[model samples]
Target: MITLRDVVLRRGVKVLLDGATLTINPGEKVGLVGRNGAGKSSLFRLLDGTLHEDKGEFQVPAHWRMAQVAQDMPETDQSATRFVVEGDVTLLAAEREVAEAEASDDGERMAHAYMALNDAGAHDANARAQALILGLGFRLDELERPVNSFSGGWRMRLQLARALMCPSELLLLDEPTNHLDLDALVWLEAWLQRYPGTLLVISHDREFLDAVTQVTVHIEHAQLKRYGGNYSRFEDMRAEQMALQQAAFARQQDKIAHLQKFIDRFKAKASKAKQAQSRVKALERMERIAPVLAEADFTFEFAEPANLPNPMLVLQDVDFGYPGEDGAGPATIVRGVNRSVLAGQRIGILGANGQGKSTVVKTIARTLAPLAGTVTEGKGLNIGYFAQQELDVLSPRDNPLEHMIRLVKETTAQGRLSGQPTREQDLRSFLGTFNFTGDQVFQAVGSMSGGEKARLVLCMIVWQRPNLLLLDEPTNHLDLATREALSVALNEFEGTVMLVSHDRSLLRAVCDEFWLVSRGGIAPFDGDLDDYQRYLLDMAKQAREAQREQARAAEPPAPAPVVDRQAEAQRQKQRNEQLRPLKKELAQIEQRMAKLGDERAQLEAQLMQATQDPARLAEAGRRLKAVESELATVEARWLELSEAIEQAGA
Candidate 1:
């Protein structure tokens, strides 16, 4: 159990929580949601006992063990598995005690140490750590790799895995899905679902919150407000609450206005002097409701492109990959691909991590060229590419204004800019749209938050006014509001978009078509996200089976079976290709379920309304029934296929 009563939390001079009270019971999976900079992290700090409340009481069960992701990036050359295993502090401590006891050869001490180690489950800790690592999307081979060898995103993932490895009663996860691809995200969800401990997660991912969190804790106006049920339920409830609050606020405003008017008219009059004085006293005594504010309504738009080209970009017999150690060798990631990007198309690219989704994006964005095929771009084609690795585009030391200015200068030098020299005023004005204002526009890009950096990147891309946009995980760091703004902007934009993101909300909102990048090839997926999830499940199962096969070493390789092996490889590729549409249909069914869920919620909300039509209520119920029937059929097929695939993979 945790309780914060009249708690005043401050960082430097800024107050985050002032006289706020909240209670969290044991085993509650709470989604901590707030606008960016609302001190959600500070609250986590409070829970971790690194920060203390300036006033009032804050309490947590003394016996409870807390586990949280480390704030710093790991710099050690430690094996990934070792790093994760060490997260079990109890196991580590027990092992140390056992070592000490053995060194002294104290029979009693050694006996006690052995018991403690056994109790701590030290023997199986490594296996548990490995499970956490694998669930977070690490390859089996990579588990033994040095931690320092991985990229920043992978390192962050490792840190998350390490935290999950810990045996704790309370777990704090801050943006755990930040670096995850869709497949990894789903895996994490499943893993978290099975966790028996209490969880308080800070995330802007609506789908994730809806899936894992049973309760929602919202921070607003320096106060904690609790809502029952998942994020979807919270949103619905919050909307209603805000509506009622706003109505009461409006009424209060009218009353205040009337009193003020009367006081103004009678303050100097002898006959009404007493009445005016009383009115003034009443106004002074009256409590005011804070005006409802939409948390930083962020909205930005991309200007229409100068030219729209059919088949804006084409990849023919493309074999794209990275160059090897020597200039003579090139390693292939995606091979034998054929695709076209047409003007005004919104294409969502989906795949498991390391399956060439980013590679395809890089190829289309021209960051890397196709190894063995021509990438033909239509005349006058321009690209505004948002790299998943933001550092590739953003200069650390440069200010937002400086970056924008440099972009214009670079474009002019490259003969890509037809506009006049960019003015500082124009740049600042543009940067302001992204909430970079006043001195903020002068702050180094490196000093900003990930969400801010992402916004700055988008700001730069918009300035380019490219005909085509290639966005790779653009919503990774964006809060729900900003993601919504981006989705709306993408929907409204005239240019073609090729987006690679794990954000289902963004994909559903912005994309009309899906492309599955898998098995060294890219194929058009005709299904929605749910089917993709099913496909991912099958893929993961097969991968696990492959690992098991490798570990068992049950079959010996034969040189004469080359043709059979080649044929097997060919069949696997064909099988993946064949599974694409079924995945798509499953995805459509998933999408339909989501829509039906939303519709049912809306109907229920309307039913509670005094003004709702009875006929409309009946019609809504009928539509819901029809949707349920269709969903049942699709879900049945989904189950049948899932089982079949599972058996086949086995």
Candidate 2:
């Protein structure tokens, strides 16, 4: 457990956290959410002890270990395993001791080294490392690959895995889901949900937070406030806060206006003059509702394209993978995947990180060649692909308007539209729909915030009016408000959409079908994400019950009493020292196991519901099996750990 008492953080002239006092109990999962520049990251750093506060006391238990998941990559060429395993500084010291003992060839030193290793939990460290990495979406081969080869996103994942691997009492994760694909994100959600250690995660992914976190911490006006529920519940509270403030302001204004009128009418009367003076003093004393941060006005409307044919895009047995990256047995990111996206079908892809979600998108967009498969385009179908990292694709020198014009001209050149003049007003209107206002439209795209630039990129895609849209992680850089607007626009869009995103809320809101792109094949799940999630939850609950029953069955029926009090006391003393950390770890792991079980059940139920749609049902079934397999692994590990603890206790 960690506590912050009147902590304040400052960055140059800006005050980040002002007199912030917060206490996080053991095993609490808190979601840190706020608008851009609201100091969520600053507050996180202060809590994690990475950054010192400018004022006030930060109280953290001396023995409580903490780890933070940073967004950026560390400058290192070490393999993923090295990056994570090296995080256990204590464990590393034990390893060094073991090496020294081996070199010295001393029996006493060797015995001490073995005990130290056991205390550090270094003996089974490799197996633990493998589970943590796999849970975070890395393959066994990628575990030994040099981390330098990974991009910033993948590096972030490595950082997250490292943070999770560390033996910590509290975990501070910032945008933890950013680099994760559908599968990894899902696993992470379940992991965090069951994590027994205190956690504070800063993320824009609503579903991720909703599924895992019970508390919501909002940073506003350089102060920290807590809410009882998740993101949606926080939004409701925020709305209520705004509404109450508005009402209070209205009453104050009304009183002031009435007082002014009374003052004017009764200036000559002594009693009335005193009353006016009192009113003026009251007005001066009133603390105005901190000018409600102007919420951006958003109205999204994407112009519909001309009539398009059914079966907008078709792929038959497509195979995809990064040949050398994931290892060269064809890598096979996705195999035997066949999909037909028809007009008006909004599809959302879900899977773990590194589970070929993006590969599926790239294959559909023809940006990456399918290792072996057939792709057929329906008659008159036009596709526009939006990469998750689209900022890299933008010309820094060009403004939003220029980029829009260029894309329009280029796309129209193929006679998709004959001599249709680019409409500047239409462009502006589209930009406005994405929350790009007057000056924002003219500003250089590079100068805009990530959210603003994302809006600009989305504006360009809408401007193209392609019959089929392939959007990869469309909600990545977008703010909550903008994401909501986007949800509306995508839902209203007439074109078929194949979107790859980890945002479950957006998927549920906009997608008519869930297209699961994983290790092999494309499976579609017809039905909303909510239902799918529900199915997963149910399946996990069932699994947990089964696991509990099995554990009970495996236990001996007869009980044993302490035959020797002194001997038992000695054994208890030794056991206490070893059991403390192990018990703590087991509790954390068990929580995560329960959460994972819930998710597996939900996916299974969703698969069952989607049986009517063969393609979708198949995809759901595949994902269900994958979830079950992952659940089994975690369950087995938990059993092994629990049994080990029981032995240690005996």
The candidate scoring highest on TM-score is 1
For residues 494-533, could you state the per-residue lDDT of candidate 2 as single tens digits? Answer: 8888888778888878876686654476676656676666
| lDDT, residue 224, candidate 1 | 98
Which residues of candidate 2, in runs, are more than 4 Å off?
1-8, 70-79, 98-113, 149-152, 282-294, 297-299, 314-339, 351-356, 369-380, 395-402, 417-453, 526-650
Each prediction's whole-model lDDT (CA) = 0.89, 0.77
| Residue range with the least summed lDDT across 10 consecutive positions in model 2 | 535-544
Candidate 1 residue pairs in clash (backbone atoms < 3 Å): 527-584, 528-587, 531-586, 531-587
Ten contiguous residues minimizing lDDT sum, candidate 1 = 641-650
Q: What are the candidates' C-alpha RMSDs?
A: 17.6, 17.4
